[model samples]
Target: MITFYDILGIALAMSIDAFCVCICVGMKYNKPANYMRLGAAFGFFQFIMPVAGAYAGRLLMKYTGNIKYLAAAFLFYVAFHMFREAWKNKECKVYLSDPTVGVALLMLSLATSMDALGAGISLALWDGGIIWASCVIGIVCALMSFLGVFIGKRSRGYVGHYAEYFGAFILAVIGVRFVL
Candidate 1:
């Protein structure tokens, strides 16, 4: 069974991408509505993707043995992706006056929530309460994106950049927990 802290950690880990991307959006578009829309879009994606992945994971779970190992692999991949991005340390810029609409929004949301889907696969294999887990993840992501925008506008992307590493660390630890 997964603990509350585990869900929270996953949520935080899953959110860092959206948070980092929104920081870039915030740097350019300084509107409150943009922040909400970005957060909502990302949060909605983050909410739904994991649910979808968990159901998909359910199908895969039946054929698998020691599913925790598979779960850890997924989580570890997500963690590695984040860590790799952090190491690259490149500032991703959204060249738009309002990035909360149209293709940009959809692509960004999907990109960030990919990790959540992977996490859902891992969690679903172990726990039956994925809806709750996904919900917490969405809420935390929305809140983080909201704050990330504000921080970005104020700090010029300095503070927001390092968060990915911390989030990656959390995910890596959780992934380790799954196997051991």
Candidate 2:
């Protein structure tokens, strides 16, 4: 059984990408209403993706016969990708004068929540409660994203990238924990 702390940790780890991207969104738009919109979009996707992934994972597990290692592998891949993106793009700039909405916002939400899909697969392998876990993930991500915008507005871009690195490290650690 997955403890609350474990679920919390996973939710936080999954929220990092959304938080970082929301920081960029906040920096770009710098409007309070935009923060809410972006947060909702991110939270919604973050919620839905895991449920979909968990269902898919259930199907895959039947064929694969035990997917804990596969889950760890996916986490590792996500971690490595996070590191690579952080290193490759030392700084990100968004030049739109207006807040992101519509298709662009949807794209952004989907991009950031991709890791949660992998996490959902792992959650299934571990026999965790998908509904509760996803709810927590969504709520936490929404709050983080809302805050990230404010933080980004006040600070420069350096912090957001480093946050991504930290997130990657957290995910790698979680993946290692699963393996052990």
Candidate 3:
């Protein structure tokens, strides 16, 4: 069903934002538990945003069907940009070298998951079960984000560039598939 695919796609798309940010944050922290906390925070936000969006989306029925396409377009655009950056033979750089904890993490989580909020609106329009979709999104984001942080901490040298390119590629592919 469209709902299922939308839920899956939204989960993947939204998770990437948190994943990318979390990876950068991982570079700042030495303790492993910090990574877990970031992931959990991201997961929680990713989960909540959609449910809220879905509720709001239901109130605006006219725009529901179009959300997927919009999300896909946005994702593809991001992916292409990342891919271009990666393809360029430039030195890898860290954007947020000093990630904050607690309040900072909360801010980052909410900010990054904005897309998920939009997707949640779409999911609500599709009559997707909020509980199930939120849980899935939460779990998917938690796992991917945790992995991203782990990998970033471990491979501090060359992984950042690759992660961007890979994430971008994934977004583009998902977008193209949705458009098709």
* C-alpha positional error of residue 149 in candidate 1 after TM-score superposition, expressed in Å: 0.6
**Residue 53 miss distance in model 1 (angstroms):** 1.3
lDDT, candidate 2, 1-180, per-residue tens: 456776787788788888887777777686878888888998998898889888888999999888888888988988898888888877757657554677888888999999999988878875567998899999999998988888878775558888778878878888888888
Q: Quote the positional error of residue 131 for candidate 1 in Å.
A: 1.1
Pairing residues by index, what is the TM-score of model 1? 0.95
For candidate 2, give the lDDT of residue 179.
86
Residue pairs with colliding backbones in model 2 are none
Off by over 4 Å in 2: 97-99
lDDT score of residue 18 within candidate 2? 84
List the candidates ranked by lDDT, beginning with the highest.
Answer: 1, 2, 3
After superposing candidate 1 on the true structure, give the runs of residues whose Cα lies further than 4 Å from its correct spot. Answer: 92-94
- The RMSD of every model to the true structure, in order and in angstroms, is 1.3, 1.4, 3.7
Q: Higher TM-score: candidate 2 or 3? A: 2
- What local distance difference test score does each model get? 0.85, 0.83, 0.69
Best model number under lDDT = 1
Question: Model 3, 29: alpha-carbon shift in Å?
Answer: 0.7
Over 4 Å off, model 3: 3-6, 62-100, 161-180
Q: Which residue pairs collide in model 1, if any?
A: none
How many steric clashes between backbone atoms does each model show? Answer: 0, 0, 0
